[model samples]
Target: MKPEPVILPCGDSALSVELGAVIDETLNGRVLALDALVTAESPPGVIETIPTYRSLFVVYDPVVADYATLAAWFLDRANRALTPPKPGRNWQFPVCYGAEHGIDLPFIASRTGLSEAEVVRRHAAGLYRVYMMGFLPGFTYLGGLDAAISVPRRDDPRLTSPTGTISIGGIQTGIQCLASPTGWHLIGRTPARTYDPNRDPVFFLEPGDTVRFIAVSPDEFTALERRAAAGERVAEAGNP
Candidate 1:
């Protein structure tokens, strides 16, 4: 358990708390704990807390709360939460491995020297890390993929990958929120919408939240799609 958040020269914020090399539940619990501390005992003019996998950005009003003051306060509490807690919630998401959902499945298969089914099997076999979130809302950088499954991203990225596109690249797996350009290989897709603006919190998954993949049949995929199109909130695709 590493203590003392590293203060850096962040462009927008006064002080930053860095908990390096966070994996599994450690990242999520630490993030939540630190956020609680800052928000509760915050100095005057403290504006917001932007938390990541192993860091939190404390943006404050330079007038009321200077950089030096808030930073020390944060360091004090952070050092104390290093004892550790229970692991994060494990979420298993269903995937329709190949064909349309996995447009570049064959590409990954060919490159990795395995059949498409084998590629899917290996991909869904292991647990992954929630390294960081960026490029788009709810988009997470997950680690822990087997080396054999690793493949380079596309040189010419697609213009739009649509929403719920589950793809992999290098050592990370990403899910595109809304429509956006991507270089990751499309291994599968989820009919379930991961983020919704109208919903109270919008995005469902956060940094430090862990997820697993569950394979599904084409018939199940169609059933899930119909439910989603009907305006039902598609979490885990079909109703639990």
Candidate 2:
């Protein structure tokens, strides 16, 4: 299908809504607005919102709710959230592309027939919008990648890349929160750790937020690594 809003039963305790194929900042705003409206008129069981590239997965408490009742409420809010999503802030996250940080940078440059510098410049040229967070705890699927640098996934997925590995997958750019196997082309690594199971909220960076990438040097990544190890925090590009 082209892309449309879809709601599905999620194990009786939760409900999932696929918001459709949204790729632009404006569309992202509309999705978030519709999400907010639904939350505002939240039915008894509604719990949280999960926004993605083209969908929003609405999670709710199943103990007190059922799909039929909540789906009706959702459909109602979807009708209203059509106005637009209110603008949110843009975030910048620093990345040290290539080498140990980005294992696939060289391979990608070889395939794309461009200098590594040009690749990095294109990757960092524009701010990306947080399309959604899923697949992992704090991982974010964002838009705004320049198609010129877009490439296919790696044939072999790594056992895990360190948390904060910045990578390109198809037309999207993503930040890794925890080490996990992935097929995306690795371009850089970030100093930011957006997920912490021990932390009160556990996750930061919700959908509809904007993200920017600032390329950093290898030495800086080493310093940031040290700071991270010492329990001292590195001043990453984005705001909490």
Candidate 3:
């Protein structure tokens, strides 16, 4: 049975519509469907909407739309758009897994009882689903990790991980676009600029997108970075 959504106040002008308590794809689908519905409907005074793992935060102008009225409208639209999400675009990112780039690969392999090469192969082979984008702009929360390679987060978080770092923690994997502190084990690095403020869209990946990590050599990494810096689209899209 589908769970009843919980509408909660979020700050003065935003309300969060939680579709489910768990972080599952089905729940995320419902959340995203309602997000699409809200965007298409474009209710008066609505400013923007942010979709997370299983919730949608609707921001509106309080002067034009009251909280009680907005909350009721959100719930009404959510109930009407309960259809499953359609498959999103499939994107392939080139990743270079080496000592300099993936500093935590060896440790992750040792902890997971797998060889470093095997770990890389398994991680790259995954057809990961983008559950949501958070923590940072273009930082994707990816699902569909191979359980055999799954490992716990580091006891001590790294002070700063480089941009394009691909890592895994618990049962989830993710791609970080900015230098930030992290506990996830870094297994590879991509040259694709997932977040570029100067770009047309400003974000390369989105929630509901599918990702495939393609292993590349150090030489290829340098070439790709140059192209990406020159504003070339590093990631290619296909049918998911």
Highest lDDT: which candidate? 3
Predicted candidate 1 versus true structure: per-residue lDDT over 1-240, tens digit per residue: 465467675654567787665444576568766776766667677898877667777788887876777767776777775543343455567678889778899999999999988899998887765655676876767777878888998899988786778898887787665778898888988776566676655666655556777888888877886776665545542221
RMSD values, in order shown: 3.5, 3.0, 1.3
List pairs with backbone clashes in candidate 3. none
Residue by residue across 107-152, what tens digits does model 3's lDDT show? 8889988999999999989999899888788788999999999999
Over 47-160, each residue of candidate 2 has an lDDT whose tens digit, in order, gives 777765555677778788878988877666655537666546667677899888888888879888999989999988877778778888888888888888889877787777
TM-score of every model?
0.80, 0.86, 0.96
lDDT of 1 at 171: 74
- Candidate 2's C-alpha runs over 4 A off are 1-4, 21-26, 197-202, 229-240
The order of the candidates by TM-score, greatest first, is 3, 2, 1
Q: Distance (Å) between predicted and true CA of 30, model 3?
A: 0.7
Worst 10 residues of 3 by lDDT: 76-85
Model 1: pairs clashing at backbone N, Cα or C within 3 Å: none
Candidate lDDT (C-alpha), each: 0.72, 0.75, 0.88
Off by over 4 Å in 3: none
